[model samples]
Target chain A: MQERTVKITNRLGLHARAAARLVRQAGQFKSAVELKREDTGQTADGKSILGVLLLAAAQGSRITIRTEGPDEERAAAALLQIVEEKFGEEAPDGLF
Target chain B: MDSSNTSHSRNSKLKGLAASPGIAIGRVLRLDERGRRQFYYMEVSAQQARTEIKRLREAFAEAHARLKEIRSNLKGELGGQHEYILDAHLLMLEDKHLIAEAEREIRSRRINAEWAVRNVADRLAGAYRHIKDPYLRERSADIEDIATRLLTTLSGHTRFNMSTLDQDVVIVAETIWPSTVGELDLNHVLGFATDTGGLTSHSAIIARAVGLPAVVGLHEITKNAGTGDAIIIDGAAGEVVLRPTKPIIRTYIEKRDLDRERRVEASVRSSEPATTLDGVRITLRANVELPAEIESLALFGAEGIGLYRSEFLLLNRLPELPDEDEQYQVYRKLAEATGEHGASIRVFDLGGDKLSLDGFEEEKNPALGLRAIRLSLKAQEIFRTQVKAILRANSHGKLRIVLALISTLDELRDAKRIIEEVKRELAESGAVHDPELPLGVMIEVPAAALMADMFAREADFLSIGTNDLIQYLLAVDRANENVAHLYQPLHPAVLRTISHLVRVAEKAKAPLELCGEMAGSPIQAIALVGLGVRTLSLAPASIPLVRNAIRSIDQSRVRALLAEAVKLATTGEVEALLGRQLPRQAPQFFAALSSLG
Candidate 1:
């Protein structure tokens, strides 16, 4: 299993729209990804947007991710890529 | 000049209205070749006339089918009424009497089929002009609609409604129909100047809905605007300028762009939450009426939908109930749209501004009548259907259910009992639904806010419906234009109620939020955050400004201010303190929103 604790840098933290984008990216990998808030220890399916949002991880909160599969390294890397990039700096076009 | 001083009758000009609003310096495309627009029925045997009628019927059927398909695809965007309008057209055109009359006229007059169709079209169109209901009367276009269809079928050509004229055009008409609005190419169109319609009328509604600039109720505009005449349409001020000077045009153009840019920025910034300078967070959500409104969440940056106002399904129709599945579809869309943050759906808050009950005869007062939680108590079945739908949609995303206008603990208890009843019903029916549904109440009336401590202990959460809370606490009917000035959201009494409720909620460690107009207003939002209100629900458009205000404040100082403001004796004293402290931190938002008071 690959695991890492990352600070939620995006102003919104891991809210709904961000979770959706993260889950979409996570699903691209063959690895099974799971997220857990550092403080609450609430576990969520990294690929299910609903499970991620229900956690309500606020801005500045820290969360940990766990991955297991042949592509675990790639999944963790890509998921971190989105968090680090701040989901492309702007919300998706036509979001409203 | 008066009939050579003998007849004493002044000459008058017949007014054939240009119906669509616009002033254009283009060649008159007067639709004058009425006969040429249609194909004539050839002089043939009775048998051929019958066959020709059959062919026309078939053509009409095909056209109706196509129109229905177009209407169905557009149902979500244009709403159900548009489809009904098309259906009305099909029924009127296919009326047996009307169709047979035209065929009879064709055979008897021994004239072309074009003349016969025109005669029938004119009669039907004229009948609609006198109908009492304005919406129905406007259906006269259905006759013109049929004529256009027949003309297209007969002439093997389609007439384009939009003209690419070289000169500037300001549309002047009695009323601009939606279809005409849809057909026009706005590139060459300057603006719409209409003779009739108030702010909420169809033309005004459509113009606002479609981002068009329009000024209505300009009487005699048809006579005022001439071909090749220059005109300026000022929709904001409801004025039309004829032969405007170059400087005036330049000034208007600048104002138009500035207004457009501000609106664009507001929309763009709407999608974020309010965070204080010290990083204190406040939830900002949108108020929506339809499922499609969910699409705006990202644009508005709302945390979730604060007020769902689910009464839409029950209002404006027969008092029939909507089943769980139908309600689930709407709730699910909202829940899903909030992405992961989820939405708070206030169960059908009917009665205040809306009336759907059958037995509630005319009352001397409606604001204090049986409404909101009271109505739900009366209509158990209607209430259960809403609860069931909400519970079912819980599987889709984060969903919280709140009951509005709750006044007593007993009301909350009674609502809980009904929710239990719905749970039992859902289980007995083996329906798929979330078993654990967290329910809350709106702390609006003074009694509710005063006793919120007890109710917060009973319910999972509480949402302060500020609009009602302010009105009820101050004994002000906000809708009454006469006393609307007294609708004070920042009143110390209202703030104290909020402060008390938040304290109680904090003691119980219960979730609490505010879903009211006050939650969106700049000064009120700052005061709310000062009172420790972390979650706020507002209109989508207000999200950015509210967020900007929150981001500019120091949370600890705000708390201190709230502590001081609450101790004040009167609402006026509290208002004075807030006026001094808040604007210093958020001068722009405070200045813009203070005028709203």
Candidate 2:
């Protein structure tokens, strides 16, 4: 398993659209992707939008992304990159 | 099952908001969702669990297909602008956690698929409700929406099959979503009575658009009603009678027939002008929100579209405002549809309780805060785009611009200046538009009504939006049950304020129209015409009744009645005077009104 912790960079945090993008991205890999909120200890399936939303990860919150099985390395790297890039949203997250 | 012979059978009435105008008596079809937090729960055997799982899978597949179809259809119409929201819904449907969690509950808890699904959805929604962010909290509604769809599918009442219902029935539910109303087959459905919704809710709007008799906000109609119970819905009176006695049913049938006959008579005479006996011509127009409602204008004999609320367009495409081109197309369609009579497109009245835009902070008093004209002025970019679109569509038909909630002279002047700026830009761009397009001000705010003389002089036309005016003038919130009784239309203050507006508009020689709930009622229409108002705009269904009322009354007598009514000290006195005097003057209109009750 490959795991990496990252902070929510988008101002709106893990909102519907942002969570949707993450889930769609997670679905592309042949790995079981899961997310765990650091402070709340809440865990969610990265492939489920509802589960990801259940984390309610607000801005500046830290979450750990864990991926297992065949494409774990790529899945973890891709998710980490997306989180760092703020889900390709504009700076300050104006596209509400 | 002959309940009529049983003395124990309960006969009860439910009071709710009069969402649509008409009468319907039929057997009840209680659509799923017995209550907001309650569902049909049952246990299943080990072998039956497998069958339940298969049923759930099929339901998911059906819901997935329906969502995709709706997405593609919306994409075709809106150029894929709103696909992101639908895409999110699609992803939720495909969520492994949602599906697997429900399946696991059905197996472990030995409950039915519907119960399992509801259990999982409630948990998820409960979590979402606790979310501190308002935007994230609203996501719970989406989950509930999906669960309702699944439940409906599991109930074997898929929207597609609603049309195949063998018998006509009145739909009783906790709350019917607006989208579901569109999918219902009107042929088999007589009307709707729900536990929740107000007069201006989207479901109510759809019910009006389709001409279905609906009574909402009943609180517990679904609990009192069972599938196939004898039901009667008086949409005009906002009453729902369940398991009605035979005699009550017969009386309602008579009332229904008489109402239908009167409507037919009104419709037949609808083509004639609404001229008073003394030769004053009254122009009757429609207050519409959707394009679908425009088709009923001719049927109801509305001469033109008076108040076309443009906020509906915004409501459909929320969080993201429709761009100039998108708004232009809708405005253009409205202009062309209204034809020579023209349409007055009011700028979007956002804020308040209507809709909360992304950037707007939660206000303690939204009704008195940045709403209507204030929001438009503050959000100049959105205001400018809408004004530019209205101007661009002016070339198609006789279109007028109406601004809502202009409480100050500066607000009116600023809105006019912005409109002028947009017009100038369009002119410079060589866009074909009506250069002489008229601009009107909605006299809804108390301050606006007080400054009617100045507004009438500056505005090309004036419209009295009595709904807000009455609410503000009386300091009564119509939505608050405690104070709603004080929100009277015939209140002495309301009449005097309207009388002042009419006199000022006449002095300025500006065309004035009253477009509000007051104008829709036959009794109030009489009072308004008596007060020197000549043009009235109301819902299309109300036009026939108001026209018949207008045709039946002699203006001279009503004017004399108004003279006495304005001197009354209270709403009760004014109402009593009109109730006693109007029937004598317009017996035909009174007879029709009596038939409805």
Candidate 3:
């Protein structure tokens, strides 16, 4: 399993729609993924929208991701890529 | 009275049924009484008293069966109060004492069967008039309807024949029921005007449902519309036109055609999202009262239902609790209607402007009184039933539960606990529903918005119920017409509160949506978008206008306008800036604002 922990820098925490977007991205990979929040200690199947919703990752919180599958390395990198992209920066227009 | 003394002496042409059991001066025209007779009528021979009783029993059975069918369909569509009307109909249909007394009178007095039926109806109607319940009082119509049908059957006039009604006649009546309104062919009918029934009454519901041009609650419409006289029914403005000039007629026809064309265009654009010039996509959902209203959801291009006021299930003298299965059927039907994007059912927000429970006396100040989640918390059984119903409907499509009037963390926690408990019960029972239903709260109260971050901690999402938020924040009563003008969501303080709440939810990473009357106003709705609110729930009628506004606005320009408006000192100042800037940058937004009044 490939694992890494990163502190959330986005001002808004990981919301349901954002989490859904993350889940949508994660589903693209042939990898089993899990996201565990440092604050709530809530772990979610990175592939499930409901699981991701339960994570409720807030700003300044640390989230650990574990990937295990054929494209584990790419999955972890892409998942990290979204976090680095700041959840599609500036609310992606009209999503209130 | 002499012919000249008669009220409708001027227009002697209109004709319609006596709907409200009173003499009304109305223009003569083909009127529909089909729906009134559909639920009643005795077909058995009057010679055999036993067979007549048997036929009455069968009629009662049919009424009971029909009530069950319409009850389930109309429960969530109209308010639960409507079903009581059906209940009264069923009670009168199976009135053993009334039937027995009428049977005795028929044998003893040797009265005609039709007169016997009419006599029973009159006594029952008189009894209904004595009843205190406004709902039961309306049931007097059901009695008259059934009696009319039975009398018609005996006379062999099975239908309320309108063969004498001529074309080009504007019919006027004291009141109209759905059945009577349904009989008039719109193709030949000029217009309809009535003195009774409120906006959501059966008459109005049918008028809007059938797309007829009707002006209701006009006190003397029937007296004014003279026969063979040029008359116009201003369905749009709720006005009546009499002896209108050729120019005026031409103008009305032009306006009517334009309105029809606009409605057609709106229906066409209903399925599309509100996307901006700069490619920003906004989810525009609809706030609906009935499932029938959902027909326009697709026509308005609603992303989904934002606020499904579930309190319609709790109103009236509901003898038993609304079961989980019953609630599930309603929610499932709504969810299915919205299709894949689904609906968000705001759990019953009862009290204040809503029906008061029989036991709970009126509060001194209902605005601050028990309402929404607060009332639900006090009445745990009612709350639990609603939670279970919503949970059971989750599997049909995307479903979310939104708790209203949440002002504190403890309330949120308690609500969350109740929802969790219901989920557990469903699990234990092996109820077939989506276990992971997303739960949220409407941030309507100022306290809720002020402490939105705390709510975001436990809740799955947040939708701003700005209608109450404005009323509560401004200390203004929305229903009171005096300070209704003061209820402005565009006020800097209100905007700041929304901004703060959105920022807090963003900080917590909780998805947020704004579903309010303000979200439909182009000026206020665009401002919310600039303040970082992306999802807007609006009335279906405003969808195309709002969608058109969003499409015309450039995000960068809107962003700049927001930055300027926020630094402003007052609501007036912000309005001034928007007035100057919006017209220049977004002409469509300015156009929508102009059309507001």
> Cα lDDT of model 1 overall?
0.66
Clashing pairs in 2: none
Residues B459-533 of candidate 3: C-alpha lDDT, one tens digit per residue? 899999887888788887754434545656678888888888878988999999998767766777888888878
- Segments in model 1 whose C-alpha atoms lie over 4 Å from true places: A1-96, B1-253, B266-273, B567-577, B587-597
Q: What are the fnat scores of the candidates, in the order listed? A: 0.00, 0.67, 0.00
The deviation in Å at residue B134 for candidate 3 is 30
- Alpha-carbon deviation at A84 in model 2, angstroms: 37
C-alpha DockQ for predicted model 1: 0.00
**What CAPRI class is candidate 2?**
acceptable
* CA displacement after TM-score superposition, residue B316 of candidate 2 (Å): 3.2
TM-score of each: 0.53, 0.70, 0.56
- Model 1 C-alpha lDDT per residue in residues B271-320, reported as the tens digit of each score: 45467878887878776654545676687687888888677555434366
| Model 2 chain A worst lDDT window (10 residues) | A87-96
* Residue B91 in candidate 2, Cα distance off native in Å: 19
In candidate 2, how many Å is residue B43 off? 16
Give the higher-lDDT candidate: 2 or 3: 2
